[model samples]
Target: MKMTDDNKEIIFNNITKWLRDSNFVMSEEKITVVTSEFYAKAYLQSDHEYILEIMSATGIETRFALRIRLPVSEQQLENYENLEPKEKLIFDDKMNAVIFPQRQSINIKEKSAFLEKTISIDPKSIDAKQEVMQNISNLLGSAKKLEISFDELLSN
Candidate 1:
């Protein structure tokens, strides 16, 4: 409840364990804890990796927030942008991710694009782990659907 170091550490440890139990590969050495945040890298597969950042503060309505970022390619960004309005809407309906485009001022190329999704966890909830896992599963499924949609668009 209080954003103390001990509470943060406990939550981080629990989340790390949950992730490992769910078959996410992570190295303990890669985990970082700052004063107000915890960061970790998780790999669902060799190619599918995500950055997990958890943050808590005093005044925020959501006591604990977990942000997951999955990197995508420039091609994926292009394909997503080219989708028809209705198709885009359908994708939005299925995925709870915000597409972020990264570009350099000189090059102006969409080289690094990513999907980011945030989940708020009530630390007191008995089903917090289940909720987090379900969110992850849904996110992965949507990512797969996105890939299929890109392939379909390419074919057409």
Candidate 2:
């Protein structure tokens, strides 16, 4: 959990390489990196957030969480006075990823509310350092698909 400079660089390099390989423009302006005792964070253009956290209990294992935050549809929002209650509240846009145990998510923001979908990973196999970097492309792909779907739905 202790984030050393070398550790931070390793994590940063992994993410940088992945973003570039995935055809995502990785410029100084779009990427933010931070490392602390408990976790390392990488933010991609403020749209994607990836974190590596060591749980309180080592037996519980370390986890990498990738969260893709996309804008909520015009209609679907975070708070409402009159609401439709259902087992699963599916958003009308790409933000409507209600698949549980996989894409666990939530909603909130201000200027434009967003739906944050998170995918958790176990990094024991991939070098712990490269875990988040390795999966970034997959994360972005899913996010891109969601964006496309949102656009499609909006058009219709």
**Maximum-TM-score candidate:** 1
Query: Candidate 1: lDDT of 84?
Result: 92
Candidate 2 lDDT by residue in tens digits, 12-31: 35545565564455433222
Give each model a TM-score. Answer: 0.61, 0.46
Compared with the true structure, all predictions reach lDDT values of 0.55, 0.41
Best by lDDT: 1
Cand. 1 Cα-lDDT: 0.55
The whole-model C-alpha lDDT of candidate 2 against the native structure comes to 0.41
In candidate 2, residue 100 scores what lDDT? 36
Per-candidate clash tally: 0, 0
